[model samples]
Structure formats: structure tokens, C-alpha cells
Target: MEKWKKDYLKGILRDYPKMEDYYLERKEKLLFHTKGTHPHSTTETQNKKMLISISLDRQLINLERNQKVIAQCLENATAETKEIIERLYLSDKQKASLDLVADQVFLSKRQVMRLRDHFFEELAEHLGI
Candidate 1:
């Protein structure tokens, strides 16, 4: 009947998929926690908008730092070296051979051979070589 009761019911329903039984078992405690008591002030709700804004800022900061690292790594690298690292690290080929990567990337075995030189060159440069 009350607005607060409606909001509490809605919140519980939304969380049903994630932890159905646990939520059901703790339904009384959960409801009591959300609908604050007189002295403990269980009725007060935290601002969802503020929490979301804080989380978004965190995600954006992480994104910017990651992009900066990527740019710096590529700044001193040759295009060929970038391709080699892609094959080695990003091609789902931790233990795969160069020939396989070459085939996947549509390059020759000789080109793959050159990739090794490029990989070391960039790696060393990245590590201040």
C-alpha cells in the first residue's frame, strides 16, 4: 500500500535471478534492513544515482589509463612488430607455432619468420631496450 513497500518489493523482485533461494530465506531480514526501524533508521535508502556516478567514473579512469599504455607501447613499435605481438598474445595462440599464426593472419611462412625479429625488437624497446 505504501510507496516504500512498493519499492522494497520491486528491489527484491529485481534481485530474484541472482540469488533466488538465499534472497527468499533472508527475505525478512532484507526487508527489515531496507525498511529502517525507529532508532536504527532502517528506512533510509542510499542514493543509487550517486553510487552509479561513482562507478562510471572508476570505469572511465581505467579505460583512459589502459588506452595510454596501449598508445605508449605502440608509439615506438613498427607495424610489423604489432602484428607479431597480436599473433602471439591476442590470437589465441599461447603455444601455437608461427606458421599457424601466419596461416590465420594470411601471411607467408617467411613473413612469420620476420615476425620473431619484430616481436623482440618491440618488446625490448617497450622494456627500455
Candidate 2:
């Protein structure tokens, strides 16, 4: 992968958990409206308006789509792959180095690096990057 693409994928992996919360927050913000802004509008019109707003929200759409793609990729991932991802990207603690992760998982540092690379490749493919 190009350097930029690799960076982008790494960012997505790092922010996966936050993205879920952010998505919900964005959706809620989009759904909220002033009390009397559409006082005369019918229920169907309000629903349609909300649908259009959501469809037009590029950031929200991308976030939601990425979330789904990540979820799908993870669903079929091996246990070791998931462990590597969680320790390296999803942990609440300080980000782990390859050597640290390898020790925790009982693999060599080189093997840990390989697994991480493989997972990134799969994620990139799924994201079409």
C-alpha cells in the first residue's frame, strides 16, 4: 500500500471504537430539530425529510459504512488476529509496540508484525483502499 493509504487504515483501526459512539452522536444531532421548524409538516413529510438529511450526510454515511465493513472483516477473523488487533489498536491503555504484543500473545516479534500486516491488508481490501 501507499504510505498515505497505510496511514489512513491505521487511523481507522485506531478509531474503530470511537467511530461507533461518534456515529450515534452524529445521527442524533441530525435527527434533532427546532420545535416549531416543521410544526405544520405531516409525519410522512418529517420522515422523508429526515431520510433525505441522513442520505445526504456524507460523513455519517462514510462512518456508518466503514463501521459495517470493519465489523464484517472482524466477524470472520481468526482468534489470534482479533487478539493482535485488540491489543495493538483497541486497548484503552497506551498503544503497544510489536515486541510487547508478541510477548503477551506468546509469539515472536516478527510473527506479530506479520499478523498485524496481514490484518491490515485484509482491512484495506475490505475498505477498497
* Top candidate when judged by TM-score against the true structure: 2
lDDT of 1 by residue, 7-119 (tens): 43333223323343443344444444434433443323333433344345543444344344445655666676566556555444355577787887688878776765554
Question: What 10-residue stretch in candidate 1 is worst by lDDT?
Answer: 9-18
lDDT agreement with native, every candidate: 0.49, 0.83
Write one digit per residue (lDDT tens) for candidate 2, span 10-67: 7887889899898888888878852236889898888888878878898898998888
The TM-score of candidate 2 is 0.85
| TM-score of each model, paired residue for residue | 0.35, 0.85
